[model samples]
Target: MANGLDFFSIGGADAHDGARAVHAWHVIRWLLCGWSLLVIPAFYGELTSTSQGALTIARSLYLCMFAGFALCLLWMLHTSRKPKAWLAHNRLDVTIMIGAAFSAGWGAPPWQTVEWVLRLLFVGLVAIRIVLSLKVFFAPNRLIGLLIAGAGVLAMAGAGFLWLEPRVHNYADGLWLAFESSATVGYGDIAPTTPASRVFAVFVVLLGYGMLSLVFASIAAAFIGKEERALRHEMHRDIKHLNAEIVQLRAELHALRESLTPSSDAITDAEALHSVPRDHH
Candidate 1:
């Protein structure tokens, strides 16, 4: 985000060492990543069999993992000397990432009901990170994957509800009815005919199409104009500067060799004679 004003430059301290310290901090953070990937599956496995005591332990571990990740983000902010504007932009992403990690760890309702929400947010975080890192236009194709996945997800939720609802015949029917009506094609086999279900259907129709358009509708309009082009121009400028520095370095090396060369008098008579004679001689 605005690359913060080279904090090391302002601090008047050894920037390299500061950079190394950040590197070391990142190493610790990734070690925790490894620990989480290893342990979280086990914790998730226990969710069904475990009593509240065990759930508490699992949730504690989950929360701590997220807290550790957030600490790394905080340290990055501390090391950066950027203006508030830059920090504000960057912090949104860090906050969202942390929030999603926290939700994945412990947040819930019946999970069946709220799972769609969690998955949407979770995948959204992934999409944002991917877009930020790549920053390239697959456009006239800005992004299709997120939209396709979201639609498919809603459809799956609908189909799943329809298949599973009849046994218990409670809220699942409402979910199936909602997505079905949202897509604007409902089967009489599963009737929502209730007012509450009709309202839910209306909400889903609005939310579904709106979200779908929000993600994919701009695919035809990605243009890398002035500001982005300037970034590439700056990269070219840096390359030119490095080339000049290399040329200077080579010239300095040639001068050093010339300075070390022996003068005529310093060369022994016998050695001088043994060397190749001039054409005039």
Candidate 2:
């Protein structure tokens, strides 16, 4: 069984080297993921009538960042010792990029309606991917980290909505409103009164619900996946122990059988003693 087992083993300089490589990859991935988060604010910022030069620059940066993300995913897939797992983790990012690229060429004012849709798609896809692929981001051990991240996103949404909504007095109020809306608390104190605010609220609601669903799903998946891996590891240990016991038992049985066998000289002497001389007694 030891000879047959072909899984990755932890030991030696090679294991250390592989661990370093994995750490480097994780850092690169986190950097790329963080960079993509800026695209949302940058895209929304461009909605204001800025200089054509600035708009072009923003668009270029946006595309470049996402392209870099996609390239990293591709590189991971290409160089991965576990290509299947890498593809499973990153296929969503690639799909989002491909979809956005196709949509970008559809009409004039590339960054207008279609752009908004693309941005929403990108946001949704990234959120889902983060929940699904990046267990480290939502690790159960760091419950406070998840809360902080969720609060940060909520605050950003609130700030953006505050700009679009006229009624919100301050960032704190806007954040409260965003939280209430996302939590479905909808207290009568603060509501979206303006048309823009209402529209933004619709988006906020949909986005919030989608994020909530993904977060729950991701948590469930993480637990189930962890249990499954643990079970598999335990089973492997049991199997190896059983195999070792079987080998030891077989060796003992072989020795016992040898002990029970008659010696060659004894067998020969017994045959000779049983042999009678032909009519010479």
Candidate 3:
């Protein structure tokens, strides 16, 4: 995925540059989505079974995702006028992709360890991309989209528990444990026993906490926004009413001045006429 900071420059000085940036962004976003879809199933398959067929499929999917990442980088490079700058901004992506490629290619036992580490890194990168994409593209109902994403992540974590946690015999129990762990409720039931499951539980707990906090913040913001809008509407209405009253008062004052002017002039003329007649007599 393109750097989130670069997204703001989609409208550049040149129209063609802007168009290329937008196209690159869309291509990267879609490719990231596809990689996410492929990786989830592959990860689950590898987690659940050690069969050669399952391993083959998972490997194939991983290769495809890696290829997609390379294609995204290439697309951005080709479309960008500032190739050096693009590379500079995306050093993390380039490093992850190179690491993934090296890990997949090397055959040593130590390389196997590197492969797993790289996988974790790639997963983290994808998670960040998913969150950023949801925020940028789903602006109209961002909160709802984020909630759905959080639920999906938790559900997948629950599925992981089903395979990792021996105590989680059934899918429902796995979900229960996942939720309880994530919410920090514990409930003294369905705890993870295996080291792998415990580690997975830690990940679930942290991810869930962050996502849940975001959900609550979004809800509060929505309520606060509604209150602000209502207050603004009331203020506008009161201002309009005050303006109308001021206009009416100004009109009445003008009419009162007009009405008094002629009467005052007639009284002055009568006084002058009486004073002149007395002088003539």
- Each candidate's TM vs. the true structure? 0.32, 0.52, 0.68
Stretches of candidate 3 exceeding 4 Å from the true structure: 1-16, 36-57, 106-119, 137-150, 245-281
Candidate 2 lDDT over residue span 1-281, tens digit each: 33322211211112233564465566566666665565555444445424776566556656666677677666655555665655544455666566445433332243567656765666566555444445556655454566667777798878976786667878888898898777778887888875446646766786677556556766777688899999999999999999999999999999999999999999999999889677665
Output the worst ten-in-a-row residue range by lDDT, candidate 2: 5-14
| Model 3 per-residue lDDT tens digits across residues 50-138 | 57676666666667767877887788878888767767765555654564454334333222666567656665665555555455633
Instruction: Return the candidate ranking by lDDT, descending.
Output: 3, 2, 1
* Candidate closest to the true structure, highest TM-score: 3
* Off by more than 4 A, model 2: 1-24, 49-54, 81-89, 99-119, 133-135, 139-143, 188-281
Which TM-score value belongs to model 3? 0.68
Alpha-carbon deviation at 222 in model 3, angstroms: 4.1
Per-residue lDDT value at 195 in model 2: 44
What residue pairs clash in candidate 1, if any at all?
A: 138-141
Model 1, stretches more than 4 Å misplaced?
Answer: 1-65, 83-87, 90-147, 155-178, 181-207, 214-281
Deviation in Å, model 3, residue 9 alpha carbon = 14
Of the pair 1 and 2, which is ahead by TM-score? 2
